[model samples]
Target: MFSEHRQRLVRQLPAGAAALLSANDIMPTNADGTMPYYPNVNVYYLTGLPEEDAMLALFPGHPDPALREILFIKRVDQLFVKWLGRRADKNTASEISGIRTVFYTDEYWAVMKRVLPLCSTIYLHTNEHARSENETQTREDRLLLACKQLYPLHRYERLYPILARQRNAKTPDEIALLRKACEITEKGFRRVLQTIRPGQTGMQVAAEMIHEYMQHNATWAYEPIVAFGADACILHLRANESVGKDGELVLIDAAARHQYYNADLTRSFPLNGRFTPRQRAYYNAVLRVHKQVAQSVKAGILIKDLWKISNNLLLEELVGLGLCTTADISKHGAQHYLNKHCYHNVSHFLGLDLHDTGYHDEPMPAGAVITNEPGIYNEEECIGVRIENDLLVTENGYEDLMKTIPKEAEEIEDLMNR
Candidate 1:
């Protein structure tokens, strides 16, 4: 699978192009404190190795087959073994990545000096995701600057755009991992439903989810968002601090990560295992839009059009619920009238990252994994209803990967009460 990812990039490269991707830096926190290390996804996507300070360079048309593909890792010395506890040796790195030519970091400059003079263009990796703020410089970002200073003349291309096109579509291996992640997430949600009670704190419900994922040998794709009452009105409320009363709603937005692939899901439940009349009414309305929008997704549909379908359906439901009228929407723009309740977009590309890399304006392609999440929040009434499911786009339509995870109100009530 990793070989196929590398070959896909090679197929897009111009002749005499050398592409380089480096590992992420170990970020530091307070004095002598460092955050957990995560391998650079671009490097991991192609090489299947996650060690820090690793480097991968691909020169497709190089005369030397050995230099055609090379990987660099920190040398397994006594110091490294003593502190970091046995980083991958050259042999192990090659064994895992299937790259025959592996070198120590000390050899990188010598290797690159020899390879770059033979290539006409250099492809470099950087965070090109549209939503990325890029406030801090990255290891790859520094490499880009240094290459321009030293080589000075070779044409450089952005490798991220090429990679985005490749990574946006899931391969068979990637799909399998995502499917497993969704299944694990399903287990976590089920754990919550079985144990959560009306008197429990929101964090207590969150603890059930964490414990379940840990048992499955998985980690959070992101922190769980478990909010009760009007706290749900704050979209990013993650503390799960307050107590959930018998009549209030608790929204749990959480998922599990399996083998580097992630699934995203969100569900709201009543603490008493049965929604009040008003809560059920609003919940059913969101469910109506969620179901319809999910069915409308398929290959070749413009992403914007999907948003339009979700927005129109949600607004019409609100009007039907007598929250507002057609006249109100027309007088004050549709968004202005509905923004308080339905503020966020209904879908996003899901994969290695919760919001994975993809062109926002592009058509939904076959084999792409995406999310369908439609939500409504009423701050005054302290009600928030969001139903999310993961989907796989096919030639004809989409397959709900989370189909086994119950979403209908009756299904949830059944599980909780039983």
Candidate 2:
């Protein structure tokens, strides 16, 4: 799976370019402790190694075939192995990554010196996601500074854009991994359906979901959002403290990360296993919009139009729900109603990161996976409903990856009652 990914990247590099991708730094905590190291998605995509201090160098135009691609990983001594268990050896790395040449990270600079003089252009990796922060300097950042200082005259190129575009389109292998994650997510939701009830704390509900994910050798893709009633109005709920109450809804936005790939899913259900008349009204409205927008997914469709389609459908529902009138819409515009009760952001690409790297404004191509989450939140009325599902765009239209998960109001109620 990874060898093909590397060749996809190499094909786009300029004839005389050398590309470098570095692993993430092990961050420091408050008191002599270090945070766990997360693999750099760019490097992980290419090499599949998650060890700290790892790096990947590619020189497609290099004269020697053996020097064309190299992967460098940390070398551990016996003492380190005794304490921390086993690490990937050179042979293991090569087998996992399909790259024939592997070296210890300590030998990185010496090897670079041999190949740098022969390449005319250098490609460096950095976190260029729109949501990324600039607060801390990463290992990749340090690498960029040193490479520029050591080889001052080399023309530099950005590798993020190339990788971002490539990652937007998933391969069959990546799709299979994401599907596995979705399957795990379904297990979590199914467990929630059987156990959730009034008087349970939000954290307890999240526990049920996490239990299923961990049992399947998966972890939460992100922090679980288990908000009950009006607490669901918090878009990104930070604390799952609220207690479930009869006739109220519990909104759960959680998924699983299996083998580094992620699935994002959200569902809202009644605390007592059945929605009240008003709750069902609001929930069905969001479900209708989710279905309508999902039909719009295909090649050459602009992502912005998805928001438009969802908004337009939500607007009509708002009028029927008596939240607003056509006259009010004429006066306040759709934003007024949407801003008050719903989130206009309907979809986002999902993969390694929860919000994956495809450009939102452009026409999406086949193989793109996006989340369809249409939500309605009314804090004052103590009702919040959002239904989210992962989608895979295809040449014909789209495939609902989470279709088997119980989503309809009748289906949810039946599973809970049974």
Candidate 3:
């Protein structure tokens, strides 16, 4: 799978160009202790190896076939292995990455000297996401800076745009991994439903979800949002300290990561295993919009259009609930009323990362996966409801990856009460 991904990337590159991707640095938290290392997703996408201080270089037009693909890894020693365990040996690295050419990190400069002369352009990878606010210099940053200093005349190109375009549409193997991730997430949600009680703290509920994920050899794709009642109104809420009241709704936007692929899911259910009248009204409204928006996921549809459709459906529901009027929508615009209850967009691309990379303005392609989450938060009523499911775009329509995960109000109540 990794070899096929690398081949696709190589085919996109120009004939005389070379590209470089590096593994993430082991960040330090305090003295002697380091934070858990996560390899750069792009590097992991091209090469299945998930270790720090590793790099991949691709030069499709290189004269020697052996020199076209190179995998550089950390050199192992007795002292380092004693502390950090054994790193991948050459044969192991070759087997994992499907690249026969493996070299030590210390020999990267020597290998680059031989490879750089044959290429006129060097593709440098960087975090180009609009939301990225990375201040610390990464391994890729250092390598790119050093490359410019060494070879000032070589043209440098940004590799992020090409990678973003390619990674938007997942392959069959990636879809299978994603399906496994969603299955693990379903287990976690079921556990939460079975364990949740009226007096349990949000943190306790989050622990239950994490326990289920860990038991399945998965980890949190992102920080779990286990918000109770009014806390759910605050998007990206991480402080899971509130206690669940009997009639209040608890919104959990948690996901599990399997083999580096991610599954994002959100479910809002009542603490007492039944929603209050107002809570059910808002929850059903959000579910209505969610189901409709999901049906619109297919090839050649812009994500922005889906947002527009969701907003329209949600506006009609808001009018029915007496929260907003059609006159207000006509005068102040639908966004004005929609913003009162719904703060975020309806969907986002999902894959290796929770908010995966993709062209939002462009039409979605087959094999692309996105989240359909339409939420309504009423601060005055202390009612927050959100329903999220992963949708895979197909030639005919979309596949609801989380369809089996209970989303309907009666379904959730039945499972929780049982």
* Every model's TM-score: 0.98, 0.98, 0.98
Off by over 4 Å in 2: none
Q: After superposition, how far is residue 179 of candidate 3 from its true place, in Å?
A: 0.1
lDDT of 3 by residue, 1-418 (tens): 9999999999999989999998899999988899999889998899888898889999999999999999999998999999889989999999999999999988998999999989999999999886789999988899999999999999999999999989999999999999999999999999999999989887898899899999999998988998888888988988467888888899999999999999999999899998888888888889889988888889989988998888888888888888888888899988787778877889989998788998878998898999999988888988888899999999889999999999989999999999
Backbone clashes in model 3: 0
What range of 10 consecutive residues in model 2 has the weakest lDDT sum? 238-247
Runs with alpha carbons beyond 4 Å of true place in candidate 1: none
Q: Model 3 lDDT vs. the true structure? A: 0.91
lDDT of 1: 0.89
Model 1 weakest 10-residue run by lDDT: 232-241
lDDT of 2 by residue, 1-418 (tens): 8999999999999899999989898899989888877888888889888778789999999999999999999999999999887889999999999999999999999999989999999999888888777799889999999899999999999998899889999999999999999999999999999999999988898889899999999999988998888898988984366778898898899999999999999999898888889999999999998998998899789887898888889889989888999999999988989999886589999999899998877889899999999998889888998999999999889999999998899999999999
- Itemize residue pairs with steric clashes in candidate 2: none
